[model samples]
Target: MVKSELEKLGLHFTNIDLGVIEIKETISKEQKQKLKSNLAVSGLELLDDHKSILVDKIKNVIIEMVHYSDELPKVNYSDYISEKLGYDYTYLSNLFSEVKGITIQHFIINHKIERAKELILYDELNLTEISYRLHYSSVAHLSNQFKKVTGQSPTFYKKIGKKRKSNLENL
Candidate 1:
C-alpha cells in the first residue's frame, strides 16, 4: 500500500524497507508535502530529521538482528552495526546514546532478555539452547542477566507462562 502510494505520487523509489526508503530521483517540496500528508492520513509519519532517522535505523537493525534473526552474528554487535550502517562504531554509539539516552549495549541486552522470555514462553527451547541461540557465553550468564533484568529466573518465567496459558484457557 505504501509503495503504491509513492508510485501514485509519481515518486521513483529504488528501495523501501522498514523505516527507510530510497528514491531514484530528488522529490520536489510539493511532492514531499503531498507524501507526508498522505502518509499521515494513514497514521504513518515520515522521519524529517537526520538524527531521528539514524536513530530509527539503528533500532531497526538491532531489533532485526536480536529478535528476528535465526542466529546471532559471530562478530561483535558494535562492529556489525557499524559495518551494516557504514558509520564509525564510536560515532554511532555516541549518537545513539545521546538521542535515546540509553547506551546501545544496554538496549541490545534488554532486547536479548525480551527474546529470551519469548523463547521460554514458547517452550520450544531449553535454557541452554536459548543461551546459545542468543549468543550468550553460558547458561549461567544468561540466567544472571535474566534475573538482573526481570528479577525472575528463567524457570520462574516459564512457570508464569504456564499459569498465564492456563488462565487464558479458563476464560
Candidate 2:
C-alpha cells in the first residue's frame, strides 16, 4: 500500500521494512503533508506524533545500552522501558506490539544483532570482545541469535560482506 502510494507520487524507495521506509530523495514539507493526508485517507498514519515521545524514550534507552554501556545492568527490560517511558509495561508493550506487529524483545534483538554486525565488520575486535561490548551472555549466545535472525553465522556474513553498511536510521 505504501509502495503504491509512493509510486503514485513518483517517489522511489529502496526498502520498506516493518515501521521504516527508505527513499533516496529528500521530500519537501508540502510533499510530506500531502503524503500524510493521502495516508490518512487510506487509514494509515504517516506521522505518529502522539507516540513520538514514548518512542524516543524507548529508543534512547536501547541506544545507550547498545553503544555506551560496557556492562548491561541486570534489570528487567520491561520495567526499564516502562520507567523510562512513564507508562505501564503492559500498556507500552501492547501499543508497541500493535504498531510494530513484533514484540519489543524481537526489536531489541534485531538492533543488537545489527550492532554486532557493525562490530564484526570493523574487525577491531574478536567475537568475545563483540559479545562483551554488546552485553551478550557469551559469544556462543551471540552467534546463535545472530544466526537465528540473519540465517547465516556471523563469520559467514562477515566473509560474504556488506557492500554498503546500514546507518542507524536504516537499521
Candidate 3:
C-alpha cells in the first residue's frame, strides 16, 4: 500500500486514507516526484500539481466537510466549492469529471451515505434525527437514497449486523 511505501521511503504519515495522506513534514520536490511514481504503481498519484490542484482541493474540502461537520449545511455546494477553491464551479466540475470520472455531487452523496452509515451504526439517533442532522429532506428521502446506494434499508442494514459496515476510507 501507499502508506507502507511512504514508510519505506523514510516518510512518516500522520494520517493515511483512501484518497489522501498527511505527513508530518513537507516533502521536497524530488521526494514528491518519487512518491508520485511509487504511488502510481498502485494506481494513485500526486494531486497537487498546477493542472489538477483545483480538483484535489475540491475533493479535500468535501472530505473535511463531510467527515468533520456535525450537521450538514444547506448552502449551495457549488458556491462553497468555488469559494473554497477560488475557481468557478463550472471549471472545477469539468476538471473533476475529466480527471476523476465522476461528478462532484456523486462524490458528496457517497460521503453523505458513508456518514449516514456511521451514525446509524452508533445507534445514537433515530432515522429522522439522522436525516435532519445530515440535511436530507426527510427520513423517507434518506432511506430511499441509502437503499439506492447500499441495496438495503436502514433498518435492514442495522438488523443484518455490523459485519457489512464499510471502511470510512472507502467513502
Q: How does each model score on TM-score? A: 0.86, 0.60, 0.70
lDDT of 2 at 51: 70
- What does the lDDT come to for candidate 3? 0.84
Ranking by lDDT: 1, 3, 2
Report how far off residue 14 is in candidate 1 (Å): 4.6
Model 2 over residues 1-171: C-alpha lDDT tens digits? 888888878788899875567888997777788878888898886754667546655667777776676666567678777777678988877777776788788888998998888888888889998987777889999999999999999999887665444444366
Of the two candidates 1 and 2, the one with more favorable lDDT, higher being better, is: 1
Q: Which stretches of candidate 2 lie over 4 Å from their true place?
A: 1-53, 67-71, 162-171
Q: What is the C-alpha RMSD of each candidate to the true structure, in Å?
A: 2.2, 11.1, 7.4
Model 3 bad stretches (over 4 Å): 1-45, 162-171
Q: Tell me the tens digit of each residue's lDDT in model 3 across 80-149.
A: 8888778889989888998899999999889889988888989899999999887788999999999999
Clashes of each: 0, 0, 0
Among residues 3 or more apart in sequence or in different chains, the pairs in candidate 3 whose N, CA or C atoms overlap within 3 Å are none
